[model samples]
Target: MTTTPFSVGTFADGDAPPFPGIVVDGRVHDTRAVLPAAASTAALLTDWDAALTALQSFADAPAGAGIPVGDVRVLAPVQPPGQLFAAGANYREHVIQITVAHRIGAAGASEAELRQQAERELDERAAHGEPFVWTGVSTSISGPYDDVILPDVGEDFDWELELGVVIGKVTRNVSAEEALDSVAGYTICNDISTRSLIGRPDVPMMGADWLRAKNQPTFFPTGPYLVPARFVPDPLNLDITLRLNGETMQKGSTGDMIFTPAALISYLSCHVILHPGDMIITGSPAGNGSHYGRFLQPGDVMDCEITGLGTQRNHCRTTEH
Candidate 1:
């Protein structure tokens, strides 16, 4: 079957063009054209056959059915996900860069110290390197075009652009080959974070959860649209890039991931029941703000793009106290 282009947007009146956008099952609709609408796309995801049929019809319909992308504001595709899973150190270079950065600059430790630290950390991780890590509540999710607010409570704010997968079917103990069949679609996610919060030296126990650091309001700017899984011939072969303002910050490919999506799904399935509308954010590549000697500030615009998934532009703004 052919792939469908899934979009969510507000429809403009007869004369104006329709706003093209995408939405996950249940999310807050931001388009002024559309009244306050909160709905979940989960029902549409339970059956791949029905979901694909609906998406195909939607995509075939002309630019207006009261679903114009131009009129409606595009929010993160998924809403109230059952699980927001993430991969830590999924990219080898990122792991190296993060470790090196923490050791030399913030951690104030020598190479040997860093190596020892990383080894000890890895040893602990190795013991528990199961599937994926489940994050906190949905309060941490945000739209792709939304402004990333820097928390006044923290100093080290960082950005991580990752390719997010939206699950379609429920399956447990699925094999790597079977994993791909569960994917509903793909979208872009910027895992905005507060390094200081997760990397505090005083909280030796907390260490860096990466999950908490990455989940903040307006932190996961996703969407533009959800490209049906069939469209992605090879999920691992896509090119992923991140730009600050107009300057390129990260240029890499999904091929660099330490664990493929299939592997991740297989591993994750072993631990928890995978269900529809669950999200898995493949780890970000190198050139993240933390590793590149930069941190987001008020007014900075971040553009995150993945090949085939489209681009999501996010502006950095501080919330008024």
Candidate 2:
């Protein structure tokens, strides 16, 4: 499938600019000051096939007549999604850390014991290596360069960088082989979380419920731009990295995933219906806060990047109640 090539830009320090050759009347104005309204909007708005088609026509216009690619302010490819789905423990190393952290107390178990227990658990889980999925509401979505608000209710904010997939069409019960067909593109996402909410003891599930921690508003920072699936022939072989205030924090690759994107889509379709504009965060690699004793603090900055997809930079701030 061929996708129209589009450029992404962000405001240097404020609201999106409205330069005539940049973005005018809410649509991108190419170099000739010709407004391809639909294309500009379609890139950000999904489930609007007509708009996307219009965008293609606009992009095809003579080079000079097209919007000046460098003029417009580019924000995250998709501002909000219809549904945001996330997978947990999708990597062997991550799962091991989660299991040990949850089962053993805050004191943390010995490395030898942790490894032994993880090995045993893996032996059992390998037979049913399925993705553990959860949903994040639309309110939690933030732009790649937007600020990530740390809730004042807790001080255990953390970060998990993962590859996020954007659904292009409505789909249900799709096979693993057909999964890529339904994907429109990919982006980088930082699953900012609060450990206090995730580790709550009063919850009926005995802290088994991590949604509260993971689903805080503006917690999921995604995109600089969505690289059309065609640009990335293999989503499972990219490098991923996370940094805190210019300091390297975590580094790994999609190759470490216990469940691939195809398998994850297949597993999710068995229970829920996915549609255009939906998002699926494929899970992170090792070195998350829960495992390394590192947690996010206010005023901290996080920069995450995926090989094919672009970078996402967000500053930590206190969330007002």
Per-residue C-alpha lDDT of model 2 across residues 1-321, encoded as one tens digit per residue: 444564322322235442222222233543223344423323433444444454355555524443433344445556435688998877777777676666753256686687678877776765665668888887888777778877766667889999988787778998989988878778888988887776556656664556777778778887766666766888989999998888888788898887788888888888898877688999888888877787887788888889957677788877652
**Leading candidate by TM-score:** 2
Top-lDDT structure, candidate number: 2
Full-model lDDT for every candidate: 0.69, 0.70
- Model 2 per-residue lDDT at 221: 82
Candidate 1 runs further than 4 Å off: 1-39, 57-68, 102-134, 200-203, 209-212
- Every model's TM-score: 0.79, 0.80
Worst lDDT 10-window in candidate 2 = 18-27
Clashes of 1: 18
